[model samples]
Target: MTIAEVSEKFGISQDTLRYYERIGLIPRVNRNKSGIRDYTEEDCKWVEFIICMRNAGLPIEVLIEYVELFQQGDATIEARKELLIEQRKLLIARMEDMQKTLERLNYKIAVYEQVVVEKEKELKRSEN
Candidate 1:
């Protein structure tokens, strides 16, 4: 598929796709005879993987390193696994922190809700 098609299909900007290639975050996409990018199935797979990793909050440098390792053939299998494991650990820690923040916010909202209900009750009693 052309870059435009890939961009639309993946919900990513064309410029970002080009930037990914320039930054080595992804392998170079092959171009057609007219010198336009024509992403193959493998290229699309890389795009999907990169997007998923990025959405998971993986650092760009780490992703670039991972892509480089992937290009280095089978010798980097263990290294790649280790990298993914470390990233997963960090992501879990971040998720835990976010969960705590969410709980705190929920607690604050509940307190406000209770206060509002009590104020409404007081107003009703005064009217009565």
Candidate 2:
């Protein structure tokens, strides 16, 4: 498929796709005789994997390293696994921090809601 088609299918910008190729985030996409990108199934899969990792908050450097290892073939399998494991640990820690922040915000909002209700009651009592 064309770069435009891949961009539309993945909801990514064309520039971003080009950037990924340039940065080696995904393997180089093959070009047709006219010098336009023609993404194969494997290329699309790489794009999908890279996007998923990015969405999951994996660092660009980590992904680039991962791809480098991947391109190195089976000898780098264990190294790649370790890299992914480390990244997963980091993602989990970030999620835990976010959860704590969410809980704190919820608690603060509930307190404010209760205070509003009490103030409304107090106002009603004064009017009586």
Candidate 3:
């Protein structure tokens, strides 16, 4: 498929696809006789994998490193696995931080609710 078709299929813009290609995030795409990009199923599969990793909050640098390792043949398989493990650890830490933040916000909201309730009671007493 063409760049436009791939972009539409993935819900991403053409520029993004080009940027991904430029940044070594995705493997190089084949070009037609007209020098237009012609994406194959394998290319699209790689793009989808990259997109999924990105959506999971995987850093671009890590993704780049992974891509490098990937292109380096099967010898770097262990290293790539280690990188993924590190990313999982970071992701877990991030989730923990978010949970702490959520807890704080919940506590603050409870305080506000109590304040509102007390103020309402006070207003009722004043009106009596």
Candidate number of the best lDDT: 1
Which wins on lDDT, candidate 1 or candidate 2? 1
Question: How high is the lDDT of residue 59 in model 1?
Answer: 98
lDDT tens digits by residue: candidate 2, 84-115: 88988999999999999999999999999999
lDDT of each: 0.97, 0.96, 0.95
Could you list the CA RMSD of all candidates, in the order they appear? 0.9, 1.2, 2.1
Off by over 4 Å in 1: none
Q: Distance (Å) between predicted and true CA of 28, model 2?
A: 0.2
Q: Identify the leading candidate in terms of TM-score.
A: 1
lDDT order of candidates, top first: 1, 2, 3
lDDT of 3: 0.95
Error of 1 at 8 (Å): 0.9
TM-scores for the candidates: 0.96, 0.93, 0.83
lDDT comparison, 2 vs 3, better candidate: 2
